[model samples]
Target: MKHTGFRIAVIGAGAIGQTFAESLLQGSIGEIAFMDLREKPDFLSDERYGRLTSIHELVAWRPNVVVECAGHNAVTTIVPSVLREGFDVVLSSVGALANPKIRTALCSSAVAGGSQLVPIAGAVGGIDALSAAARSGLTEVMYTGRKPPRAWSGTAAAQEVNLDTLTSQKVIFAGTAQEAALKYPANANVAAAIAIHGLGFEKTRVTLIADPAIRLNCHEIYAKSRSGELRVNMSNEPSPGNPRTSWLAALSLQQTVLNKVLGAQWAA
Candidate 1:
């Protein structure tokens, strides 16, 4: 398809959000704009870009796509409004999709407007293969996420166990992807993506860990289908600004924006 540069509005200025916006501008793909609750970040340095301020302002100057780099609250509030106005969206916060009613509403909005809301593969890989495996009737899929004990400091992990004393791997949380996403929203983006893609949320299993030994965030997935089995693992370096988010997550957002703007997309 021939391309007219897309008007992109990012919805957060945190590490992942800024990284995605910076990467997009660096590649010279689209006109970079941002929408956040906070003031314009000095990083982008473009007056045309800044905080969106309110939903009214966002609808007033509608962009082709709005990347919801913010959290689930943004998804529940801003994203629906944007979608209802016929704007497609790239949702980096996959955990928000765990709310079945919210997911249905968002899907309806996209369909009503003839647009799309896509989930980015944040930290994990093997999603394409895992999803393909699903079509063949997969049996088992599990996602284990591990981050440093200090990394889990602010989270409920501290309450579950003594994160400071953990010397080896410890599974602090075990449940369905839905529960995982709800309890570990900031940390379960990749796991939620894997669950939604492989088997519906209820069928996918999740394990959360606080590892004292590993400095970087880690993600691993194992799946067995009628076709066969696949195992994928990655130890991710956190985004410079947000230690909780994987660097690859921001890159995925930027790359998707590039495909939308420049019409150059990588094959899976």
Candidate 2:
């Protein structure tokens, strides 16, 4: 693919960010830049790529779209500001919006700048069907997230279940998507995405499990609506650079960016 003179700015130098950037570069899609506090990596040493230090610098670079791959804090603190600057933001940390205040801020900021805040369907599918079903009135939406014991480390799940010695699956949490996202921000972004597409956070049921037998991150969604009933199951490999993140999440972000640059309509 030839470079289209389109530019994309990514926020974060972490696993997902680097993966998405490398994919864009390999595809020869467009110019790319990184807005991160950390020093630039050697892979981005080419003159065409940029390492920016602040949102002001990002705005000056004039990227056509900004992708946020950073964690929840960045979504709350940085994404709204970027949107307020009239930049369409592709959000990977959808779990952050589980907080009503943060969600409201993002919405208001996007409206203020006449921009859109788009959330990628991370690590899972059937979002389009769910969204359509929602329009016809959804009665139930349930999400079950299962991952290896090691992947649940450092989160509240560690306190709920013994991740080290567990020989079988253990139910760590059962609650609404809002509570699940807030409690397990790093692991429950898919739950939040499903909630946003199928049902509101309060109505979406979420269950998180830590399994010793599964090496992959697994997601199961069951929804019922006036239109029909939907069920989806996905087992995704962990990102090589980060066990806590699904590799498919990075690819989803790259696809979202490509769709934006190519002016392709993406299913919500």
Candidate 3:
């Protein structure tokens, strides 16, 4: 519905951040302030929106939630501090939690400040079903991520295979979700999201493929639990601004924010 005074602080002014901001503005859900190291984008020049320099500045702006879309480094360094300030964090870089220490720290910080770390289901579906099945005890969870060869550039996948000459799908990595997320931080966020919701990092199996035949990023997930078996497949177009990420990722974060804000409104 109408969130009159709600505010959101977004970390990172990149593609995802901009998209989320635009979506909020279009829906008139909340005001937005961006905390980023880079120069402010033209769209954020409006005086109503804030361009913050640090976490302290962002906290001072008094946002109901802080959304992290910068990357793994921001998740490690910025998110915990924001959470410790008692602001709920909508995390886009779920892959960063692959590091046990970072995950633990974020959890401790959230507990310390009485805030919550909300990880959105980015570039994938079936998270709600998987998370529900987890309570009933899941036996197995597997995720396969396939994307265009250019999408795998600059990541560990590029080093593992010749992305330029690949004519067919090549399995670049096959391991636990933790290993895959750690090695391919930019590409395996869906795997991490699956692990977090289903069988956790160690138990969730992950396979990453670089395919020359595909123009879209594809995600396939399979899980088995006492409740039943589940299979999901999604084909996502890469963001026009950044091929490394799916266009749906930004929209997912936007939906997460809306759900949080609306849920709060309903409870109130």
Candidate 4:
């Protein structure tokens, strides 16, 4: 139970990152440091953890693992260097991996530094089954995401559907996972996760729905493979401070961190 030497660094002090940090604080993990554009020196400071402002300072902290709850820019700018430094990473921006260039660079960095890049399951489920089915040859994987109409604001869905006047469920996008990620970056993590676990981005089907009747974010995945058929549906509450993110997504990241640091004996 002595996790005294486990060093965990969190990139980004945003809703998801802070949620993960607070959860980690409640556990036995030792020495948590946060790196963000803006500094909060007093944030989460305790006997075991502190905060760092610059990436240079974070590098000096020498973390065993780094969890990226930052956005896509962090994935491109911060992740590669951490991986190249031989530190494992847990990424919240799984959608960013869909980019060919970034994916290639991350994979190369992980190999070069002998590090592992772990992507959390986010707001979905059945990833274990999907991964197992993938080995036996998955024929199809489909994801349908539904959230309140206001949640579709600022995305391409705004242009396609009039979210203001929408009273019922509307299909804003029906395309491949790649297209979904390109058009709706904010809501692409679940789709990207399904694609990664089951099929490649181009082969996995994706659908984005805006429903006025729904309060929480909902995800439904249907997959068919040589082994069997699977369907998973999740209704996740929005994070308290950030409605754009599901609370379960933050909890999933915490669980991933605990599992990695504590070995296979820890289960969430």
Candidate 5:
């Protein structure tokens, strides 16, 4: 199918959101617009794009697809409204879906509007395999996230371990995916993806670590199921503009946009 005149709106103008807007524009996907809460809008007068102040305006403008690169709060505040308008959405904040209320409302809105909610596979791989194994019944799923000690600053990890004085790796948190997402909202997307794809949030286990040795963020997944076993490990460089998010996440969002515009299938 030709996406000759497809119109897309992006939520947020932060590191991830701005990255998605520029990437989509460069790819010539369509007329790229943004919905944000900025006091002033960026890239609004480029002639190739536009911007809106609220979800109401975004819905009124009627975009073909909405790519949400904003944080979890956007998932609760903006995404449901978009889906309720019958527009498809690409959700980057997978961690937000761990909230039962938000997940239910988003899914219900999508169903009511006949839209699809596509989840981006950020900072990790092998999700296709893990999700497939789940079909046969997954026995267990574990996700471990490790990052530089400095990155854990301002998070609960700071209270558990001294971020500046930590010498070696320290296990900061260990629990279910739900708890991980709630406790570390900024660093929960990967764990949430593993849980949502391979198992429910309550059943999937999570471990978080603060390492003084590593600059790059790392994610590891282990899963066992009736069909087979799966293990995936990846180290991701942080986004230049946002240390809290992986650069790979922006790339994944780009791929999700391509999948929708090109009418191609994405395994994850």
Candidate 6:
């Protein structure tokens, strides 16, 4: 690596960003700049990093790598500029890539700057094999995401069923990845990631289930191609502080940063 202690910038000082900053410091990353709208948390006040409230300053910082813990709005507003400035970007909000226009623009920026825009697996896995299956000719890709009804309160699932008093499992949404991303923005990242990797967003099948019986967030990836078939199921605990984010999503950011700085091998 050209930079021994990689200089990095973290967007969104929320749960995921704070976790990544702590991991980067413990890892080989020399100095990290944490950016967010609010002050650093009581637990995260340290001297090895910088803090900022504006996403606009990222262009001037010119970090070696930028890890995005922020949501889709940050992806649309901040990521493109970072990519245009020839910096690598690791994104946790994979669902935002469902917007083909943003995907197109980001791809163009990465190509023009000769940088890479990497999407973290977040709460789901098997993207490495799914992408390979796509190249080998994919046949079927099934993505099933099951979260408690409370988790789906803000999504369309609430309107379809009584999330508060659901006696059994209920299907909130069943359609393509595009529809899932559009209807369920919170769960879109994982669903959209599967779609973009296996088949284009329009072709990837998605089923979102809200089950009252399950307390943990669960995700399943079933993919088949000419080469073979792969299935993996993951259950993640919700972030203690932020109920909306899964624990693994934050860990994905940490692991990705570790791999970049400490040369740790990470799954794609």
In angstroms, what RMSD does candidate 3 have relative to the true structure? 1.5
Global Cα lDDT for candidate 4 = 0.86
Q: Estimate TM-scores for all models.
A: 0.91, 0.95, 0.95, 0.92, 0.92, 0.88
- lDDT (Cα atoms) of all candidates against the true structure: 0.82, 0.90, 0.91, 0.86, 0.86, 0.80
lDDT of 5 by residue, 177-232 (tens): 99998888888888888888988899999999989899999999999999888989
Q: Please state the error at residue 149 of candidate 1 in Å.
A: 1.3
The residue ranges of model 4 lying beyond 4 angstroms of the native Cα positions read 39-49, 264-268
Q: Tell me, what's the RMSD of every candidate?
A: 3.1, 2.5, 1.5, 2.7, 2.9, 3.4
What total of clashing residue pairs does each candidate reach? 0, 0, 0, 0, 0, 1
Residues 1-268 of candidate 1 have per-residue lDDT tens digits of 3234457878877788877877766665556667777665676576645556777777676676788888998898888878888888999999999999889989988988778898888888898999899999989999999888777776777788887777788888999999999888888888789988998789999998888788898899999999999999998887888777778888888777666664433321
Sort the predicted structures by TM-score, highest score first.
Answer: 3, 2, 5, 4, 1, 6
Give per-residue lDDT, candidate 2, residue 247. Answer: 96
Question: Which lDDT value does model 3 have at 75?
Answer: 95
Give stretches of model 6 more than 4 Å off: 1-4, 37-48, 53-56, 263-268
lDDT tens digits, residues 4-101, model 6? 54578888777777776666666556678877655666644676668755656766766768888778888888888778888889998888888889
- Worst lDDT 10-window in candidate 2: 259-268
Q: Is candidate 2 or candidate 5 better by lDDT?
A: 2
Top TM-score model? 3
**Error of model 2, residue 50, in angstroms:** 0.9
After superposition, the stretches of candidate 3 with alpha carbons farther than 4 Å from their true spots are: 39-43, 46-48
Task: Kindly report which residue stretches of model 5 are placed more than 4 angstroms away from their true locations once superposed.
Answer: 1-3, 41-48, 264-268
In candidate 2, stretches whose alpha carbon ends up further than 4 angstroms from where it belongs are 39-48, 264-268
Worst 10 residues of 6 by lDDT: 259-268
How big is the RMSD of model 2? 2.5
